[model samples]
Each structure stands twice: as C-alpha cells, then as structure tokens.
Target: MSPSRVTYAPVGFGDYHWTVTDDDGRPWFATVSDLEHKEHCGQGAVAALKGLRQAMDTALTLRERDGLRFVVAPVAAADGGPVLPLDDRYALTVFPHVPGRAGEFGQRLSEAERDQVLDLLAELHGRTPPETTPPAAVEPPGLDGVLAALDESEGPWSGGPFAEPARKLLREHEATLRERLAAFETLVARVRGRGAPLVVTHGEPHPGNLILGDEGHLLVDWDTVGLALPERDLALLSDDPAALTRYTELTGRTPDPDALALYRLRWSLLDVAEFVEWFRGEHQRTEDTESAWKGFTDTLEHLATASG
Candidate 1:
C-alpha cells in the first residue's frame, strides 16, 4: 500500500502515530514506538525489539488462530513479521484504522462497557496462547531508571527544557517516591509468592486502547500482551467494586486486592521512570515533550495520593 498522504496523529502516549492514506483511499494507522522506552524484558534496543515482537506475535496468534475478534493486531510487514525496525531508536507497525469513538486513557468504563470488557477478558485469560508469548512483567520495565533517578546526586538534568523541572519535581517527592518503591517491592514479593494462575493478559486494558466500532468494542495496542495473572488486566477496574464483583462472577476467581494495588503502583512508577529517562536523553520541548512533562508531574502526584 502506497501512502498518498501521512498526517501526524498526536494521540496516545509513549509512541508516535500517523494516519496514512493509501493510493486506494483507504486509511491505515501507523505507530512508531521508541525501542528504548520499552524495557519489559531487558535493556538496550535489541532486547526491547525482541520483547515487542514477542508481544505482537502473541496478539497476531490470538486474532488469527485463537479467533479473538476484539483484538486488533498489527498487520504483518513484507518480512512476514509485524514489527518493522525504522531505526535503532524506533520501530514501526501498522494497523487498519478502526473508525469509531476511541476511549480515553484514564476514563473508567461504563456499566455496559465494563461488562463487555470483563467478558472479553475472561475469554482471553482462558485461551492457550502461542508458545512465543513472553511472561508478564513482575515490575515496570523502567524500574532501574526510576531507582537511578531517585539515587542521583542533586544536580540539574541536561536533556532539554523539561530536564531541570523534572529533576526538581523528583527532588521534591524524593521521600515519597522512595517509600512507594519500597512498598511496590513488598507487593511484588507477596504477589509472586502466592503463585496465582497466570494467563494471557492485556497489560493496559484501560479505556484509551478500546475503540467502539460498528460491531462492538475492539481492543487496540496489543504491545503489552503477555502471560500474567488476571489481576494485571483487572487492575484497571480496581476502583469499581461492582466491576470487580462482576468479574469474579464471570471467572469464578476472587480478585486479589494486593495484586490490584501492586499493578496500580507499578503503572505510576513506570510513568515516572519513563519521563525521567526522556528528560535525561536527547529531547527537545516539542508538543510531545510538553505533554510528557505534565505526565511526569501528574504521575508523581498520583504516587503521593496512593501513598496517602
């Protein structure tokens, strides 16, 4: 498909996006993910690319082999793989643009939407995933970065406009951040020690990745798909007691509160860690950077709130 025009889509976080209009006048969504930002398996661009391929391969299998309709997996490239390495820094993938109302990142699903999502998750959790599926992350990919940032000596960061401000914010919440990290470590130990049944999970089942199309709700962004405890997906609905109960009814497994808290805290710290590295690297004050700055500060506030 030859792209006639490519319009920048300033939607979503972490990855860059564009809407491509092919010669046939069809729309395709293009996602460019920074290989460095993802650290689920290990460090470096190579490991990041491997982890991404594992996840995308699992998604493709689920959709094509397992017959999961809700999963909008990536389109395979010329090499018969979904991932195309754009450069050492970024990777590219394309998907058929689902024309519908997409959900917001932090928005809680409504009752009907929640029920549909829970049902979809139940089916997903019960599936026998492909052998290539990697294990779900016990901790955030960027935990080391977060720890390093917290342990750094008091000095101004030198990435770009947001560097110093990010440093100052980190300093202001140093004690709280430390406490939260300690608490997170404890939760991780508890959750792992329990030996809960692991299944294929959408790491971020939050609203932003759901698109309500003509047929029903379709889940996009399968980058986080991996074998993990069900709570990893259910953590999105932790605040909604009714949803939790409903999920229990559907799956006949009681949701673990400690597990829920563990993932919730993990997400906050992940955001903090990602922004720290972003500001510490070669960055400039573009629209994305500015938005990342707000995300950095907001997540810190969220960590404090969780602590309280």
Candidate 2:
C-alpha cells in the first residue's frame, strides 16, 4: 500500500508520527524516526527494532495465557519482516490504532484505574524474560557531556527556540546537576554490586504509556522494553502507596527503595540530555518548533526538581 494515499497527521510532540487510515478504512499509527538521532541517544535502530520484535512476541504469548491485557502489534512487510525501511535516514513501523485515550502526565487517575495499571505492571513483571530478548545497554548519564558542550560554546545560545532555556537551566543548576551525576554513578555501582534480579521491564510504565481501551487497559510503547531490574518499571508508581501495595500483593516482589530512586534520577537525566540534543539540532525536525521547545523547557524543570 502506498503511504501517500493515507491521510497523515501528527500524533504527539515527539518524533515524526502520523495517524493514518488505509484505503480499506483500517486505522493505523505510523512513526518515522531518524536513525542518526536515535543512535546519538544511545539507541541503534537495528538493535532497537530487534528488541521491539522480541517484546511483541513475548507480549503476545502473555496475552494468550491471559496474563497480559495489552496487545503489541508488529506490522509486517510484504516478506513478513517486522519493520519497514522508509529510507536511508528514517525507519517506519505501523501499529493498529488503539481505540482509546492515552493517560496524561500530571493527571490523577482514579483509585480503580491506578489499581488496574498496577495490576498490569505486576503481570508484565511476573512474566519470564524471553531468551531472545537482549540485555539493555547501560550507559553513563549524558548530562555531563551536555554541560561540557555548553561550557565550550562561546556565544549567546542561538541554536533554536529551546537554546536559551537550556543554556539558562544548565548554568543555573550546574551544582545540582553535578551532584546528581555523582549520585547516579554511585547508585549504578551499588545496584550492580548487589546484582539484582533481572526481569522484563517496560522501562517506562507511567500513565502516559497506558491506554484505556474498549477491551481493557493497554500498555503501548514497547520501544524501551529490556531486561532490567523490576524497579525500572516500579519507579513510576513509587509515590503511590496503594499502587505499591497492590503490586507487591500481586507479584510477591518487593521494590528496592534505592533502585526506585536510581531509576527516577536516571529517567530525569536521560530526558534532559535528549532534549538538550534536540535544542542543539542533532535530531530531525518532526514536531512543531514551539511545541518541541516547550517540551525541552518542561523537561529541564523536571530535571531541576529531580536533582534537587
């Protein structure tokens, strides 16, 4: 099918994405992301796509056993491959449009909804890690590198709409940033030393990744699925005592407090680094300039709070 025949529109503020309807009237969601930008962010497209296919297979297995409520659709090429090469610069993947609303960050979910999400996570973590799934690459935080580049630049920041805000945040919060980096390094060492049990973590299980669909709550965005400490997924729900209780009650796994803290800090640092690169024009332009700038500033504020 020609992609041009489908009506395409932006889905969110990150990456180049579209909601398209095929000629047969089937709805699909398509994402076209720059390979170079993905590599710069520590995700090589080939490995990432492999992990995605592995994740989809695992999720489908769990769904068959009634252990999972979510569906992971891997659109196949004519030859039955999972991913389609859009061009030399970008890759494309299409998913059936889930008829549901995505959970929004900063919005409070009802007690029932929160419990449902916690239950879903419990099921996901309780699954056996697929043998084909590779271990996640652990990279040192990138904030230090971003800081170094900012320090080396001589002129007033003028890269893009996010440039000045990024500069100001980096300069103003230099001490906190340094402290957080050191703390993150220490935590990484401590966690590695203990050799915590590895499980299939969603990497990001926040409400924003949860879809309230007609059938049930569905967890989308398998891009970051990997074998990691269960706390990698639990950290998002750490602040909710009821959710924590539900998870432990359902999965019989206790979340390590230190690991939870470490994952939260790691997430904040990663977001800051990614958005800084966007401000520096390392990524292809897919989202509106103003929206991307606002996201960058918001991420900076989140980093400041996380570090503080």
Candidate 3:
C-alpha cells in the first residue's frame, strides 16, 4: 500500500512526529521516536507499544460507557500490525488527529471543566482489563547514573551552551537531590506495604497531555500507559482537593495519600534525570537544549520544594 504525505507536526519533545494526509485528504498523526531512548527508561519500544495498545483498548471501552473522549489508537498497517518500523533508529505509529488546543501546565481550568476531567478519570479507573495484561514493573528513578554521567564528562564543556550550566546546577542541588532520593525510597516502602490495588494508569496525565476539543476533553500521549496503582494518575491532579473528592465520590475508590506522594516524587526525579541525560548526550546541540536545561533546573527546584 502507498503511504500518505507526511508533514512535520512539531508539537512535542522526546519524539519526532508528523501529520499525514492520505490521497482522500484525511489527516492523521504519526510519531517516530528513538527505540534506545525508551529502553533507557526501563522498557523497550516493543513493550511500550504493547502497553499503549492495551491502554488504548481500555480507554475505548470506557469511552463507550461514559462518552469519554480520547485520541484514537494507532491504525494497523496493511499487514494488520500496529507499529511500522522505519529503521533501527526510529519506529512509527499513526492515529487520527483529534482537533483541539493543548492545555498549558499552570493554566487553571474552570470548575465545570475540572468536573469533566474528574468524571473521565473516574470512568477510566473503574475499567477492568484482560487478565493477560501484566502489572507495570516499578523501576528506580535512575537519577544516580545520570548524575554520574554529568560528573565524568571532561570539560571545556563547550560542546553545548547549556552543558556547563547543567553541570553546575546539578552540583549546586546535589544535597537536595540526595534528600529527595532518600524520601522517594521511604515513600516507596510505605506505599508497597499498603498493597494498593493496581489499575491502568496514564503515567503522565498533566495538562500538557490533555486536549480540549469541540466535542469534549481528550487525553493524548499513551506512551507511558501501563497497569499501576491508580495513585500514579491521581498525583498529577492532587493540587485540587475538590478534584480528588469528586473522583472518590464518582468511583467509590479511596485515594492513598502515601501512594500519591511517592508518584509525585517519582515524576520529578525521572524528569530531572531525563533532561540531564538529554543535555549531556547527542541532543546537546539541538535547538531545544536551552529549554531542556531550564526544565532540568525547574524540575530540581520542584523536587526540592516537594521534599521540604
């Protein structure tokens, strides 16, 4: 089968994506990302895609019941396979482009909008998945290795403008960083001891992943979706007490504060580590390097604040 005309989408970080138009002028979204980058996060491309497929299936199930709006799953190729391999460096998947504006991180949504989001999440958490779907494995935040990489790099650090700044920021924040690491370990132990029931979680449910469309709100970016304690999703919205209360009222599931704390710490640590790795490696010279450096520093501050 002939492929569609691909135009760069230029929307997200961490992946190369495009908007493709078929001969009939119907547009779809396509994503191409490095397999190794994903593997570094503790899951390879194949496993990540499999988990995404399962999560999309579950989301569709909830959509049918609650009128939940979500991004359409990647379409299988002519051979009936979901992922199409481009080469060793990149793999491809395509989906229907839902029209909407992406939400900003610090932007406040109105009460009605918040209720809609809570209702959607309640419906999602109430879903039951196939028995064959395994629970997501918990991986250490792996920030230590990232710190080591920064320490071992010999400088003149001039290969990238942000290189020296990133190294300095890491050193300045070292004590706070170590404290957050210890706090994460302690939180993990408490959460594990409680033995919360595992549910499918959209690992990163921040406003950046939400799309407010003509019909309703839609959650995009399922690459991190997997079977985990529901708190992993709830932690992102924990700033709003009313949202948390409404979720429990809607789903009849109690939220665990310890688990929510652990997940929030986990997000901050992982993000700081990822940005550091990106800044130190081949991505150092990219146009995004400066923003990446700022993000790393901001995340470190977030970790420090949360730890306190």
Candidate 4:
C-alpha cells in the first residue's frame, strides 16, 4: 500500500486487484488467481505481474500498429504506461477512478457491445509475428505430463468438519474426468499437430477483465493471455447462451461443438476446484459457491453421459 500508488494492499481485498474511485472514495476489486508474477514458481513459471506487464506491451504495440493511440498501463505502471518494477512487481502508471454503476460487454452485451468485444479480441489475435509460436507446453517436472499431473490432492483449504459434500463429487468426478481427458489425449495431440491457426487469447475472460470506458471498453486483466485458438474467447462467450445466440447472429455461424465441450468441462472443473479452495479459505469469490457446485456437478454428469 504505497501512498503514491494505491493499487492494492497485501492485507486488503483481492489478489489481482483494481483500484477504482466511486462516491465514497476509491476501493479495489481483488481477484484471486494463481498468476503470481513478481515471484517465481518452481523454476520456469512466469509471474502473473510479469505476464500482465508483458501483455500490456503486446497490446499497446498492436493498438499503435493499427493507428489507435491509448494509454498502455493505466494505473499501476508509470505515466499510464505499463512497466515492471525493479523488484519484479508489475505496476499500472495511470488511472483516474470514477464513480458509477456499470457493467462490461462480457456480461450482458448489446449489439454494439458485442461489436466492441469482437473488435478488441480480433485485434489481439492479429499481428503476432509469424514465427512467434506459443511457448511449448512445459510438462511438469515429475509426472507423465501436464494432463496426467492435474489432480485433486485435497486443496490446502476447504470448509469445516461437516462432511464437505463436494468432496465426494470431486473424487467421483475427477476419476471420470481423468477418463474423459484420457479419451481425448490422442485427439488433443492431433489437433496441436495440425499446426493450426493459433493466436494470443485471454485464456479466461470472466466479466471482471472488461470495463466500460469513455471510448467504449477497456479490456483489463491480461494475465492469462496466451497462445490458443480464437474460439477460446468465443467458447467462453457461449457460457451465456443468450450471448451465444446473439453472437451467432452477429457472426453468422454456429459455435463449434467440440470447443464448447472442451470449454465447459475445462472451465467447470477449474471453477469447481477453486470454489472448494474458497471454501477452505485458499481463495476469494467471483461467483457463488452453490452455483459453482451445481455447475460442476452438472458438467460432470454431462461428461458421464457423453462417456456412456
């Protein structure tokens, strides 16, 4: 909590935080995620802070290349330019907290809103230097690979002693999920082997990453931006069926069945585990725990049905 730059305090709210000013002064929204950038994880893990700063650089370069001039790092970095600190902490150099009830195009977008998001996402996907391929999937140090390494090794925290119900589902479904993942191993390999058209994508684009700005929208939280199919964003958009329908109308095509399935299973499992973590105080909340539990169970059931 530096006096000069009040981005977020360690003891305060969320992890990936945003400081905004409203009627009662400025407060922040903290998102708990595993993108610890200022500090390294294991030997090769990139820090979240470093990742966001890097993304800021990429985005600004794109904006300028397209002849659009905008501030890069808006708040914690420097003069509104995003930059990494000497200690490895990322900072946004410019911000003016404003007051208002608002929402982002991601949540409930209008036709115009849809256009704005599509444009921004499109810009992100464009302009990667041809040879700049996605970083190779770094297999975890010990296990057979990343997928094989994904586990349900009892999160560090969860609810109290009252027979945490989700645990059973987590166990039962994780086994099922393991099977499902296995079934897709060869297909996943083939898909990657195809050397398909890939681009920088926001691996996750939950509502908080977007903001309503004076010009239109300012997509925030670029931590998870990475190399992936463009449909990754589209798949997330499909999480809102109405949005999906509208988006379909706008784009004049149907969402891919496979991508939807992958996004559903992937997002559902990840969200559910984090919910369990939140139950144990290992994280914070962006959505309800009950909703997560229900969705998680539903997704598992869907997987089971598919497997059957």
Instruction: Say which candidate scores most in lDDT.
Output: 1
Instruction: Please identify which of the two predictions, 1 or 4, would achieve the higher TM-score against the true structure.
Output: 1
The best-first sequence of candidates by lDDT reads 1, 3, 2, 4
Q: Better model by lDDT, 2 or 4?
A: 2
lDDT by residue (tens digit), candidate 2, 120-150:
7777777887664556655534566677755
Residue 201, model 4: lDDT of 68
- Least lDDT summed over 10 consecutive residues: which range in candidate 2? 34-43
Error of 1 at 60 (Å): 1.0
What is the TM-score of each predicted model, taking all chains together?
Answer: 0.92, 0.84, 0.86, 0.59
The residue ranges of model 2 lying beyond 4 angstroms of the native Cα positions read 1-5, 39-67, 138-141, 153-155, 240-243, 282-287, 306-308
Q: All candidates' lDDT scores? A: 0.86, 0.68, 0.70, 0.48
How much is the lDDT of residue 56 in candidate 4?
A: 53
State the lDDT at 220 in candidate 4.
53
Clashing residue pairs for model 3: none
All candidates in order of TM-score, best leading = 1, 3, 2, 4
Per-residue lDDT tens digits for candidate 3, residues 1-308, read 24468788778777888888888788888888676577422366666555545554554444544444563456666666656667645667777778888897756777677777777777666667544334565544456766585466445344456767777777778778878878888888888988878876667777888898887888887666667888888888774444588888887877887777787778788877777766665544556776677678789888777667
Using TM-score as the measure, name the better of candidate 1 and candidate 3. 1
Cα lDDT for residue 48, candidate 4:
49
lDDT of 4 by residue, 2-64 (tens): 343345533211234446444555553433333432221222234444455555555555455
* Model 3, backbone clash pairs (residues 3+ apart or across chains), number: 0
